[model samples]
Target: MAKFFKYKTTADLEAENARLNLDLRFSDDLSPLSQPVTVGTRTVGNRWCIHPMEGCDGNLDGTPGELTFRRYQRFGGGGAKLIWGEACAVNDEGRANPRQIALNPRTRDEFAKLVEQTRQAHRDSLGDDSDLLFGLQLTHSGRYSVKPIIATHDPLLDPRTVVNKATGQKVTADYPIITDDELKRLVDDYVATAKLAVEVGFDFLDVKQCHRYLLNELLGARNRPGPYGGSFENRTRLAREIFTALKAVVPSNVLLATRMNGFDSIPYHKGDNDDGQPDPWTAPLANGWGMSESDPFTPDLAEPIRWVQEMRTLGVDLVNVALGNPYAQPHFGRPFEYPPPDGYESPEHPLTGVDRHFKCAEAVQRANPGLAIVGTGYSYLQEFFPQAGAANVRDGRITFVGVGRASLAQPDWVKQLQDNGKMDRKRVCRTFSYCTALMREKNHPLGQYPTGCPPFDKEAYGEIWKEVLELKVKK
Candidate 1:
């Protein structure tokens, strides 16, 4: 078990970090974090960034409800210069959850109002909006779509679909794969969504490719037989076309971006070992993107580097790096002490997971210095996040240190850092995984649940948790 994050003092934290051969450092001034950076034609106020975190509480028609509005409003007031707004589906059928927000004709006005509310809240709290940038993450949950209309069937992702719970026997489902014609239509939907985002006053639009969404899955579609699969160019054709179409419609000031999965690890099982390591498999690695073809555990940055160079040419602002899919390989992307209800114990130390993300960010930043790179997997550091984050920014290993779950647990952590250069240890994220557990529980196609910091905002999610536990006990 990891003991370093439990330390109360900087001295003890530093001692543990040194023992682990980690070069974490802290500063009282926080000058590096407060420094302004420029992307595209705009200048951001500071280096702190809030990664996109979904609330899963939108209206049935995919409009922002009160909970969704409140979540973004708090994030705005938290003082992150660059806020990557949560993922919103481009169409109804592509939604991952029934309540997932969608940018469409009916919900356009509501989304525009939500953007204004978020910006005004930031201005009211922080006193200025001159350097703030908000980007909307647009996605199509192809394989994970709750609707049966536009689902994808990848051999690597959807093989042996049915599993008997009691006997653990595998069986296949007869789901049809998404056709190439549908992909072309998806391109149009993306372009139209981009136009709506720009009209709604967003500074940028993120074509989300992380966490095994449609585009990310397409990146690794080696077995599919179509114009959009097999070779590298064929696989990446959709993203390039989407960019071209978006650039043609949107104004030059509207920046294009992507939150991408930079690496993936082999799947693990609980019974693999007593220590929670992955089981040995003679089966070759699946057609997952960003991993070495021969060695799935190691990163193969050749394609990612090439994609970065291509993105620069296509006017992409930046790429936020997340590793693996939360459904299949949760630990690689989210380093948590506790696992969600459906998750297995972590196969490696949480610090090792954090280190892998840092290394991936370093490799991408080193290869493509011009294209900004935001690093994730830092929230596990708790109060020590600032020390390691500041060190990475100062050394130019990454452009921005992103806060995902931490933002929920402590929305005002940035303000605290700005005010005193130290955080109240009590408020720091403990990696409890309650937020993730709630998400997994309320992920049904008809479930309308709100996601937030249960421990901090006990009035809402805490009560929900109690009800959940009661139901569990009754079961």
Candidate 2:
């Protein structure tokens, strides 16, 4: 194992960690996130790819605008190598935020602008040798597919998660199940979006399979009887066929990967057991939908490894591993109440949380070193990421580490270590469970632009930051 060098966050190590470098400036080398890094057969530049977030910049109708123009330019210059265009809806209803960038037409100009600005800025920041790859997370919320419950299925086994509009009455679903043709259209949607991403300047694509989306639903044991349901092969058929075809269609230079969630904490799902069903694995659909799984998620490593193997055989470049998703249960480290309770994140919960994801990635690395494996999880504990990454790199355990939430608030997280030995540990975000909670809300609308953290959102975005900062008896 590489000698452990830890920090509070990348910001915690700041300039101090730079001295430990074995290879600086792989391209611009000075920049950590922008620097080229290796993954399986293909090389992934830098260590960071901005996690899809709400409204850093995008128009009201999901178009790129000055907000995104300036925002991406700011972060692009910050030296991030792989910049994913925001979580774009493959179809209209799939969008996470009404303002989220869209991959389809009518938003083409904005996307092109996004492509131009991000590329020009990155190129300018790192020079030609710096290879910053850009990608977008193609996602659909499924039951949680995003407001109005406009899912493919009827309200059979829906969670009935509501929207938080001023005129709030829970956003109940009348229709739920997706049709066979619709499923195929969903596949075509992914292909079209992939093409659009490539055209808009994104060099990579992550067909999102995480957070109980339409894709994972097919893969899950709970999927109702359909051509896509039943055996594991049937479940993964769409992902396999779609991504494989996309890999062929997109340019050879593009890096393609998928971010998926396998278990939901609720009953009939793999992660949770709230319903107390004796045969958790065989819970019948409340209406016609199937129940969640009882056993923990195993992610069928053999399946994805072979999948990655096939992709590499074709032209795909990466395989990111994951375990239970955030939207799913046990929810390991998230809050039961407000302020997130204490002792939750203190390494107590193992298989039930994001820790499981780490363990999953570590295993995937050892087994498939040739496949570029990227693993993602929470905001905290990133300071230990490099040391964790070293194990994967040196031992061929893993090739890359992804930080989702921490980087969201403090965009300059990595370089702070490379530049000044100073890491901003006093998180700009105060562990409020906004991220986890808001989505779980009853009518959480698709275009609902949540400003600031949750639970305490009313507090922080409401003025908690000002009050706390002022009251802190400064040393």
Candidate 3:
């Protein structure tokens, strides 16, 4: 019998402290959550993956430093079947944050060390039996770059860490529109980086295709041109190109995944044109993509067997579904958007219908084999995934389900479910959205977000705590 503790109420706790003072009960009648599943030949060290959360990779001169290695290793060692090393930039201009880890050959040694630290942390803590896998969710912030020097369709993206593209110096990025050569280089960089991950000892690489990224911006009918603009095929071509390039350089042994908005299924901005671009200079700030309160634009986009089927054809191992609208923070899926006082608990929360999304993937699988779908939208509600997936698989529906935010709060979340019979039993992850505000650095991005626990970081984000205190998870 697992013990239970409830001294603290489920309130505004930080991500690190979200899962504290909890207990579990297993039942013979209630089927166990299931066991470690396979991602190809590789068995997840545990089902709960510490989903790709972002942070500076602590690079000094385009190379990772010891401090960065220690930080990630600590998180990796804390335990996870897989850990995404933030959103690594594929090329220089594609970089969003100046310190984000880049997979370029220029930083190979640092990455190699990072790989070593990941394995070392897992081996030291859990022993040889644990095969802690690592994947890189490579991204090109495109128009939504954190660097003020970089230009995009909408210029309001918080310019906290502006980067000087030429020298890679920490300068203000300007509205520098990219050219054809730059786009090709971006594709090439993705291919080269995919190869680099294998060489550096990482397991998989997720070619990021969602949010308001370079590709997304092009595909979204914003400021794009030629064949890459018109139909969905045109829009999706870049993703296919990048993935195809990755497959060529990266071996069949490596797992390739992508985090994309399965559909732009949300309502469009009323004032803006049908495309949801919003007025670049005059419209309200929230009129654009994520700026809208309407459900995520991509959620409404789930359609045509073509998009899903193509993912399978593109050598994609997995697609982590996400909302490309307001759901993605200023930097694309950072922090988190909240509604009123009690947000996560909004009656609309959790998407009243998760099965529909699974159905879309199912339709795709019929045409394309071997492509696995893993996702639960980085929610702290970890158990909801497997419990739902277990039933889905029984009905020939879902093969895998991903749990992101919860895993960050508790890395061994999967183990807890395996050891105990039920997932709801564990009492951690108040889901207070502390991690959200910290991640967003919401007070206009000048490094205002809280990183660990606010109380834990007096020097970092105590003021940010004031905003966090306003919200509650509404468990």
TM for candidate 3 is 0.69
Candidate 2 lDDT, 257-325, residue by residue in tens: 776542233322321322212123333442111123332333335544554555566555665555443
* Clashes, model 2: 47
* Tens-digit per-residue lDDT, 88-170, candidate 1: 99888888888899998889999999899889988988999879999999998876677433233444445423333346443
Lowest summed lDDT window (length 10), candidate 2: 22-31
User: Clashes in each model (backbone N, CA, C under 3 Å)?
Assistant: 0, 47, 25
Cα error of candidate 3 at position 297, Å = 6.4
lDDT of each: 0.80, 0.52, 0.52
- Write the number of the candidate with greater TM-score, choosing between 2 and 3: 2
| Cα RMSD, each candidate | 2.8, 8.4, 9.2
User: Which candidate ranks first by TM-score, i.e. highest?
Assistant: 1
Winning model by lDDT: 1
State TM-scores per candidate: 0.93, 0.72, 0.69
Candidate 2 structure, TM-score to reference: 0.72
